[model samples]
Target chain A: MNGVKRLSAPLNEKQLLNLRAGDEVSIYGVIYTARDAAHKRIYEIIKNGDKMPFDPEGQIIYYVGPTPPRPGRVIGSAGPTTSCRMDKYTPLLLEKGIKAVIGKGKRSEEIKKSFIENGAVYLVALGGAGALLSRHIVRAEVIAFEDLGPEAIYKMEVEGFPAFVCYDLYGRDLFEEGIKKYRKE
Target chain B: MREVHWERISKAVAELFKKINYYLNEDVYNALKKSLEIEESPVGKRVLCQLLENAEIAAEERIPLCQDTGIAVVFISLGQEVIIKGKNLEDAVNIGVAEGYSEGYLRKSVVRDPIKRINTGNNTPAIIHTEIIPGDKIKITVSAKGGGSENMSAMSMLSPAAGSEGIIDFVLETVKRAGPNPCPPIIVGVGVGGNFELAPLLAKKALLRPLNEKNEDEFWRNMEDILLQKINSLGIGPQGFGGRITALKVSIETFPCHIASLPVAVNIDCHCHRHWTIEI
Candidate 1:
């Protein structure tokens, strides 16, 4: 097992890469939720020099669009969406002080390069493990784009939300590394 | 012609939507469990465990197996001798979908338009495909395809000269390019020898096959084994953490095509592979 360090809500790139795909992570802190629509809006904000709704510094963004919760529930099955869809907007967020991204799937080369240059890291939560992920989110509220429905930007407070480091600041990728180690000769 | 009751059909469809969202099919569940035993990498084994646990929790809690909840894709095989009664068949199906999605708390992932995309609110107007079969009994299959894996599906028309080797190459290329994006340890559904559009449909239909079941035809059976071996060799492993089991299974369905054309379509289902069938 790799060494695990429990840090505060906002984690740095070095701290993020310490995670591997199967490694269990307990993320305690603030995280933001954004899907395709919200991503486009965030990009527009960056392009127009507008202030983002939440502070990006040391923040982690989760790429998810959750189901509407039932009565007396915080939120419905909340799992990560494919991360590659956010590739275009990710570099921009990292440039603005965002330290980490949490989602599924491999990111593009451009996004990975930005991760190295800007000291950002990518984390992955199990894609279909919605109920499992939902157990981590203690609280959630829409911070922006309410009309976007599930795609709305929501600030979520999670306790011990599990994730793995898929991409590290050093440009090493778990997807690539795992394949090399396990592929038959 | 015998009349079919829309209300009954609607209720059955609604139940199907709910049951599939809450329950992972037995074949898929068993396959995931088996994957853990054969998976070589430690990380891969962990991922498989989480998936298995997730399936159990989702089923027990009656929650969606995945957050995306997927765009509702229904395949209906109707009996030609059956006639519809009461409400319009299409409307009933749509209502069933809306109610099922709302009642089950499945996410409404569908949008109004692809380019000008707007949330449809209730996940209504399911993408329903209907075909008239020879039997009097209506068979319906529901597959909740998550966006991540759906986005990775691809289709191509190869020259008739390409043959099985060419088809295998295309499938491998598509999986490699998809990488971790499609959610690794995927089930690859390959449809070969049909027309352009039919090829994709056949590919998707192939996914409904039992996970461990082999094709009856020896040629297709060999193709399935070869593809499965090649895919796992890619080392995409569970959730792309890199492992021996890049794919849990590779299922192929084929039809005779024109002499000049060879159509191939690949549909990828994530490990969740949420699906169920109901007949009423």
Candidate 2:
């Protein structure tokens, strides 16, 4: 309910520390997009000790598979997919030095542990709000796995992209607190 | 016999795809507005507001409400006296889906094979369910089902003695387990009293009912009312962040079944809930 915080990508520890589970923030700067299939491929590539497409250090990855842009638009309706599908491969990405993730839904306990250990956080973009979310993305291009169509990883430049910190580095989870606060006997 | 051309059906299906995807249904839209008015949590209220805005933007810009344009699911009520004049109903529907998706610039979300994981390219081969009815007209209902909510759907065959309380528990448990994954403020469609497969089918059919509509049977109407309240009480809330208004509606359709079986299924639909019907 307070003023919306503005944060830049490749977020630092101080920034991550400042955020709480329910704080709303609008992200700016570059973020990477990847979803179910791309995460699997990322897992295999990392397992084989191959070079990743981009530097993971201090980066934020958005779990999205955007629709194709109509003629003149930078991108189509880009929104967060469910985060759980990418849970299996998330630890590997966090271990590689990713700073934060933007998605929807709760993460696994293992993922929560990794967030604390790796100094990362999880953010949630409103699900089923694609058309509104797309308004924040200013530029987009496929950065890897072009053959996967919508599943391809894209590098996106976003301005004022709204998200809520769902799982924080301090082990506070908004999802858990949320249920407790709202459920009336 | 009343004769109709397959091409006409295909063209109508194509338009249905274009219109349904671009605009949210009035009943669903109004239900969300009402949820926005009554939602308690600030975050939950914000989510509902965004959903309404998203629906408006999608409609004004002619864009999809969600990127997951969904799998094409069709329910057809064909009159016994109606004769198709062209190729076939199923083929025509597939062609329409392909054209509508491509021409309207909707995302093709379907895969050609589930295991191999190949993109179907055109979002074709719709899941068509047909029932032969008594009249000379054809009625078609089209729903574009996104994978998220569809994946959370569940079915169970309970002993007749498990009874009503068992059903209440099962439905609540299914929803509680789903949490935010199915995109709460969801629509829960429940099927009761049918055999295993038919129960799930009926559950899916229940979703096709208008959000503002309730079951005609007094017993089922009361069941819908209670289920809707209990689901919201779970505090899953909008986008599962917790608040009032977790589900917009709960619909239950039933069928007579064998004395030994009481099959129940829950089919969840996200708040986006897209579908349309046409009679020809």
Candidate 3:
């Protein structure tokens, strides 16, 4: 519980500059969702200089592909997918002014360096905690690439969406530093 | 010979798939609980707690524990004295899988073709493995294997000279390389001594074993224990946040292989570890 930070999304430089690798944070706001298929499409749009489905400036993109929601629910089990798969498309999104990225697992060194150059942050959510995470997302609607099924881009409003900064602007990696303290071999 | 109706197979398959995806197996749940007790890092503990709560929520709500409800991997053991009636056995299972995925609100992850990548929509045509056993009863095991962990699966056809030391090193290398990608505190299923294809199958089958149960052979049991410690010592931890418990269990299954080959495979299952069995 100690030292956990609370911040709202669509963040600014002041909010991000203070964050460091390994810092726990609970985010509150709307976050755009995109996984492998959606990222590929989004990359194509950016490469063609077409307007993005949603403005990337000062926003967060969560890598996820959730299940179909039941009759009464706002969303289905929606947790972060692996982030490494999106490394190729990230720099373009970052260049467009996105503030943060959320997903599970390690990102490549190149992506970490990208974060530094772009002054952005990488937040790692608890992977496989879909059921728990869904409770935090109050609303979700597909905004683009509707034919992609689960991979469609979704606009979601979340509260207390928990994550930890895995990479910050300084290029410190939580995965590398976190393992150093615990590895015996 | 007992006649087992195909409709019964389809019904059981549908129900079992739904049940396993929504409610994680008891053995897997207990392993996570125990791991939580031993897990030291605050971040690791937090992740474990989230997983524990996620399982509880999924069970109570009748929703999947994870969104990637997985490709249905059905292991069917048919009695030598039984005959299947109604539809073809494989068709019946596929029907059941499609119905279950749709009805249960599970994600339809299977696609028609690997390269073309169009969703099969109903999650149909399960990966079915059948075998003949001596008894008169039909036993079915359904495991919803998520892609995250399945992507981390590894195999190597090491030379006979590589021996135990070589195999252990491979296991470590694979797990370390997998890191957080497979979702940590993973169940490591290792297959040793089978032929090229069978080795990987054995690895996947090894995951179905109860989490607490050690290998029946003392030699392999020792190997499991040694591997578990070595893997945990790597410090990947829960979701690779870094802690004491990187893997909840290491299960090894072996079979006789050719003298010239030492085939091995590692199939990683995430902490969700959704699988169930039924006999009818």
Candidate 4:
């Protein structure tokens, strides 16, 4: 096992791919938060030739739907939701120059391929670790679709936000490799 | 007949919402801790470690275990002899749900319609299933079901000839297909026998049981062991990182069904497994 790294956020695509499973990384800086609804909206925007809510180039998208914060808190229980649900919209985002995605669970083959081809990476935060993750989010504000409730797009500033690289730019998936190594006869 | 105080029930229900959200039940917490010890894959073990730490932080900070606090699903067993005082039982339950989610700051994840997808702001109108049982006390089991795991649930009605082997295969296949999507290692609640909807209902009900608690019936006990072995063999592991334990536990609940039907339902619950029960 290698020691964890604390990289300032807004990391480039190549920087994200350098992260690997079992390697702890604390991210600092700006990240966009969105889930199924916002992903759909983003895709719709792309399909309609409309401008996106945020620039996708060199950006990291986090797949999350946080609970409403308590008084004085920035966000609530801000953990990653399952990533597979956003598979359909991911390739579209990658095409627009999105560098990385942060979420939990395995992605589809198409999404995995798109990451490799587009020089993007898929990072996985611990699912169900909402409270722990929320602690890292220093500030949060809705950037778009406030009416989507928790599923709305939010721009978040995080410090020491922990994540692991589930899929790297080199076309390797930690999930697949782990399964092969541990599968029972 | 025992008089049931609607106010008391509402209070209990209200607290049920917050408790289910803020705290990871002891069984689930302990199971996760155990998983960290037994998991063989380095990545899987690390994921489990993070999960255990997350539970502690969530409870101490009084925050939800997951961002998707999930739809409020309650199983109420009302004593037949109890009489509700002052309010309609259904309305009382809904009010409790609304108050709990709003006041507790839990996410309102429910939608008014699946198609139109209107947000029901306060997570009201809980999916309440009430059964009248012979007792003077009312029992309520609160389960905050995450969409990720609930979406992975599946049910099937096979020919009676397919039998237990078919039932086991169906459950294993469903989990394998789910892969990392449902957030393994998951707890699988299996309902055998019963009709179409009832089978799934039974499976969901079985989830209320503590993790790793074996069925008391000898026949069901053996079945549980076999299923547990088969599921772990899939190597889905924690967070699907892959390990020796794909499933923390498999609980089966059954009832006699129509002779022509061998209905089976598999209800998958993520590692969070947030649930709590209250008897009032």
Candidate 2 Cα misplacement greater than 4 A, ranges = none
Lowest-sum lDDT 10-residue window in model 4 chain A: A13-22
Error of 1 at A10 (Å): 2.1
Query: iRMSD per model?
Result: 1.1, 1.0, 1.1, 1.1
Q: Compose the digit string of candidate 3's lDDT tens values, residues A77-132.
A: 88888899999999999999998999999988788888999989999988888888
TM-score of chain B of each: 0.97, 0.98, 0.98, 0.97
In candidate 3, what are the lDDT values of residues B118-237, reduced to their tens digit? 988899879999999997999999999999999999999999999999899999999999999999989999999879899999999999999989899999999999999999999888
What RMSD value applies to candidate 1?
Answer: 1.6
lDDT of 2 by residue, A69-140 (tens): 889988877778889988899989999999999988877898899989999999999988899999999999
Q: Which scores higher on DockQ, 2 or 3?
A: 3
Q: On residues B82-187, what C-alpha lDDT tens digit does candidate 2 reach at each position?
A: 9988788899889989998888888888888888998988998899999999989999899999888998899999988999889999999999988998888999
Model 1 DockQ (Cα-based): 0.82
Model 3 RMSD vs true structure: 1.1
Q: What is the TM-score of chain A in candidate 1?
A: 0.93
Better of 3 and 4 by lDDT: 3
lDDT digits (tens) for residues B128-228 of candidate 1 = 89999986778888888888898899999999888888998999999988888878779999999879889999999999998979889999999999999
lDDT tens digits by residue: candidate 4, A45-164: 999999999887788899998999989889999988888889888888988988888998887788888988988778888878888889899999999999999999999999989887
Cα RMSD (angstroms) for every candidate in the order listed: 1.6, 1.1, 1.1, 1.5
Alpha-carbon deviation at B132 in model 4, angstroms: 1.0
> Model 4 - which docking category?
medium
